[model samples]
Target: MIRLVAGYATAALTMLVLDGVWLTVATPRLYKPRIGELLADKPSLPPAVVFYFLYVAAIVVLAIQPALREGGWRRLLTHAVVFGLVAYATYDLTNQATLKTWSTTITLVDMAWGTLVTTAAASAGYAVMRWIGK
Candidate 1:
């Protein structure tokens, strides 16, 4: 149970740091001009907070914990990537399908970024659990 909690913490922190950086730097650069003034300089805190909590929980529950239980780097990495792709694709593809202003470029980029970051976060969590167990 402690190991599971630690894994969750590790995944949450990893996602927060990496996703925060991407949103701060890459998102603005890639999206601002296309999105124009619609992109707020500061995101609203309530939704952001909710999203972070749910997102991290999903990662831990669906990917990190499962990978750890499966007990292999291959399983860890594969599940993380698949989870990321599915989650991001749901968001990006839905936006592309529904939003008038959404761009395919942004959709593709975000999906790729999601896969990369989630895998990294999950892998980091797995590593942390291993270290802790040792």
Candidate 2:
């Protein structure tokens, strides 16, 4: 139980730190230049918080725990990448399909970012859980 909590916390923290940097640096350079009109003046905090919570939970459950049980780095990374790609693809493709403002470049870039970040976060979570269990 404690390990579960620790895994979630570690993954969430890792994700927050990584995504903070990306958003700070990339938003102005990548997103703003391409989709400035679509962005809000400031993000809506409530939904952002909810998204982090849910995403971290999914990572812990779907990637971290299974890898820990199976005892293989391959399993962990594969799961994390797959989950990230699928989740991000759903959002990116949906926007691309429906929104006139959405672009293929943004969709591809965001999906790549999501995959990298999710794998990093899941790896952090898996490491922390192993340490705690020992």
Candidate 3:
């Protein structure tokens, strides 16, 4: 239980910090919509574009830890589920982020992006562990 909780907490907090730096210093472009009206005001904004940026960042982080993804598919999948929980926890922190949102397609894409990322991270981490025989 402790490991599970810790894993999720770490992942969620990491994303929040990443989001902060991303919104504040690295890429102000990501946060432009944070202030706009949920739906009526940001039709020009593309959800895929937004999620793409986030997933790219997360993937970069995972890439830096190549050992994480060296494991077999079964082990990778298990860790991915935990990562999914973390991702969902992070997303849930602001359900309002989806309020007055755009079409279901956009939301589905975003969700898929999150799921893929979480799985990738788990696979990456598992690989790393297997490489190190940890």
Candidate 4:
């Protein structure tokens, strides 16, 4: 129980920090220039909060826990990357299909960001679990 809680916290924190930085840098340079009209002056907090909570939970459950049980870094990374790719692709491709303003550059960049961030968070979760000895 303790390990699970700790791992989740670590992963969530890692993700939040990484994503915060990415958004701060990318929003102006990438998203705003391309999709400024689509963006709100200020983001809606409720959806962002919910996304973070659910995303972190999924990473911990699907990637971190399995890798810990199987005792392999390779397993953890593979699961993390696959989860990231699939999850991001679902969102990006859907937007590209439905939204006229969506761009291929955004899809590619966001997907890569998602995969990298997910793997980093999952790795952090795995490290915390191992450090605590479980």
- Per-model TM-score, in order, reads 0.91, 0.96, 0.39, 0.97
| Cα lDDT, model 4, residue 97 | 97
* Ranking 1 against 4 by TM-score, winner: 4
- In model 1, state the lDDT of residue 102: 85
For residue 111, give model 4's deviation from the true position in Å.
0.3
Q: State the lDDT of candidate 2 residue by residue for 9-101, as single tens digits.
A: 999999999999999999999889888999999999999999999999999989998898886689999999999999999999999999888
TM-score of 2: 0.96
lDDT tens digits by residue: candidate 4, 66-123? 8988867999999999999999999999999999899899999999999999999999
lDDT of 1 by residue, 60-116 (tens): 888766766776788888888998999999998998898778888888999999999
Q: List where candidate 2 sits over 4 angstroms from the true fold.
A: none
> By descending TM-score, how would the candidates be arranged?
4, 2, 1, 3
- Best-matching candidate per TM-score: 4
| Better model by lDDT: candidate 2 vs candidate 3 | 2
Name the 10 consecutive residues with the lowest summed lDDT in model 4.
Answer: 64-73
- Tell me the number of clashing residue pairs for each predicted model: 0, 0, 13, 0
**What are the root-mean-square deviations of the candidates from the true structure over C-alphas?**
1.6, 1.0, 10.4, 0.8
Regarding lDDT, does 1 or 3 come out ahead? 1
In model 3, which regions exceed 4 Å deviation?
Answer: 1-72, 78-86, 89-98
Model 1 is weakest, by summed lDDT over 10 consecutive residues, at 33-42
